[model samples]
Target: MLTIIYEDEQYVAINKPNGLLVHRTRIAEEKKEFALQLLRDQLGYRVYPVHRLDRGTSGVLLFAKNSAAATPMVQAFEERQVTKTYYAIVRGYTAESETIDNPIRPDKDHQHKEAQDAVTHYTRLATIELPIAVGRYSTARYSLVKIVPETGRMHQIRKHFAHIRHYIIGDKRHGDWRHNKMFLEELDSKALLLHAYEMQFTHPFTGELTHIAAELPENMRRLCLSFDWVNAVTKHEKLTDSPV
Candidate 1:
């Protein structure tokens, strides 16, 4: 069953699991279980997706009960009025904090669409070193990062991290194949190491402020437990002094 994080007369939120599609798409034809369908069935009513989460990403997902509410919720995201906080495990030691301002093509085909400006701010929460050789290094180094995107673009987080050479763990499409293989072989991990943990926005209907959060999945928690940063980060309630 999908975990409902938030719900009201206008909207409902679910903690989506990795590899689950938000809706039907041409690229993933084999997916018979979608969040939309599962939600509709579980609630015995209709649900409209206000935003999308990557198939490999797991965490808080928002949905509107009707189209009337979906419009404003989607607009809130497009207008950059909403704040989204994501947590990721990535290869290499990322800086303490930095903003990635890069333009990304809207689609693979240049003729179809022009590039859009995309900006993402990320802060390194902690670092870990494993006694595993990868490439030229004798020990593998990784960082736990907290990311905030200033603009919404397709695959922005995955692509922006890739652009900076700190590919997120398990992100095969925009990540290093060697690092991905190592994670799978060593940790038995299969899903991308990205999670949408927190979101803050103004209620489109009630005009009140709303903040929702989801805890890291067990796999991610276990991975971060080695560094002992997850407890501190979670207990602190926020990443203070972050550049993002």
Candidate 2:
């Protein structure tokens, strides 16, 4: 059964596992299981997705129980009223906290015409230098960062981090192949190290503020443990002054 973290008369939140699709997709036609199908069958009722997470990502995923709850909740996401926190394992240790305010556009011939503003805040949580031989030296370094994207865009965090030369580990589509291959061949893991850990927003049904979180998956925890960084990282959050 799917892990239902929070539920109400109007909504349900799930700790979606990595590799599950939110709904049926032609892109993933080969896969028979999906989040929508599984959850709906579990509840024997309809559920609406309020937001999306990449297929490779695992964490808190929200769903509205009925159509009534879906509209306003999705609108809230579109308007940037939600605060999301993500934890990602990336290549290399970042020296300090940084905010990336670069704008991105669609990957089309007219990419310039469809540009959108993108902003992301990132804080380094922990760093580890593993003595694993890959390419250059007898050691490789990795960093964990807590990321907050102010603007929602397709692959914003992944693209932005890659643009700055700090690729998220295991991001095969936009990562350093050498490092990714090293992880797969040496570490026996192939999933991207990104998790949508937490989210905060107003309850569309109750009008009260709400916060939801997902525990770090076992694989991610294991990765952290390998580096002895499981306890070194600290999590911090603040509410925006704007009221619900």
Candidate 3:
């Protein structure tokens, strides 16, 4: 069942799980069922996706109940008015707080024409000292972070974090293979640690501000529980210091 996080006359938002697609995509043809389809089935009505979450991303996903609402919500995203906050377990001890303002370009021959401007703000919530063997006679440590992307781009969080040298754990495509393999073999975790925990935006119909939040999944919760800085960074009710 979908965990309804927020719902109103014009839109309904839910906490989407990891491994679910927001909608059909040409790249993932094997996905016979999608979040949009499932949501429509569960609600017994047609719905429109206001924004997209990566297949591996788990957290607040907003869906407009009708076309008129979807258009404005999409415009809000395009204008970077929507606020999003995410938590992630990365591969190193990050600084207390930092902001990454870099522009990303599509790789050669890939989809999209130009390099887009991407900005992300991140704060180190806590650092864990889990000792794991890396290559020959080497032990490695990693950190946990709360990330907020100011501008949404394709894989902005993942790509930006990776570019900063602290790739998120379990991000295979742009992550350190050694750390990925270590987590899988030792910790038995295969899913990416990134979670979209909180979101704030204007209501399409009422124009009244709205806020939605989702708790971290069991795996992430448990992982954070095993650390000390967890209480310092992870226990807060909100991810962002500023009001949405």
Candidate 4:
């Protein structure tokens, strides 16, 4: 059963597991199972997705039970009123905090020179060094960061981190293959180490402030423990103060 994180008459949210598609798409037609279908079957009623999480990224996924709720939540996401926090394990130690403001082209129009503005704020929760060496360095290093995306462009987090030279571990696309190989060979990890940890927004029906969060999946938690970035990384959140 999918782990339900938050539920009310207006909407329900779940801690979506990795490798699960929010819904079937033309590109991944072979996928027979989907979050929308599965949740509807499990709940015995239709669910409307107000927002989506990438198939490879595991964490909170919200759905509106009725049309009235879906409209406002969709607008909230579009206008960037909702605050989002993500935890990522990236190569190299990052600064205590940083903001990435870069323009990115949509995948279909990547060849075009023009791009949409994308911004993300991130804070380093902890850093660790491993004795294993992969490249020119004698050691390997990684950082656990909590990120707040100011704009939700496609692949913004993955591409932004890649542009800054600190690629997220196990991200096959928009990441270093060398780091991906190292994580797979040494850690037995191939899943992307990016989690959509938390979201905050004003409730659509009740107008009350709402916040929801999901624990990092087991693999991600295990990786964090390997680096001893425990409680801090799990509790690290800096998303709300700086919205849009």
TM-score of each: 0.93, 0.91, 0.91, 0.93
Candidate 2 structure quality by residue, lDDT tens digits, 187-209 = 87788889898999988777899
Inter-residue clash pairs, candidate 3: none
lDDT of 2 at 136: 79
lDDT of each: 0.88, 0.85, 0.83, 0.89
| Comparing 3 and 4 on lDDT, the stronger one | 4
Question: Higher lDDT: candidate 1 or 2?
Answer: 1
lDDT for model 1, on a 0 to 1 scale? 0.88
Whichever of 1 and 4 has more lDDT, that candidate is: 4
User: Rank by TM-score, descending?
Assistant: 1, 4, 3, 2
Residue 197's C-alpha lDDT in candidate 4? 94
Q: How many collisions per candidate?
A: 0, 0, 0, 0
Candidate 1, residues 210-242, lDDT tens digits: the string is: 998987766777666655664446753333323
TM-score of 3: 0.91
Q: Write the per-residue lDDT of candidate 4 for residues 41-160, one digit (tens) a residue.
A: 989999999998888899989999988889999999999999999999999999899999999887763666678999999999888888987888888989999999999988899999
* Candidate topping lDDT: 4
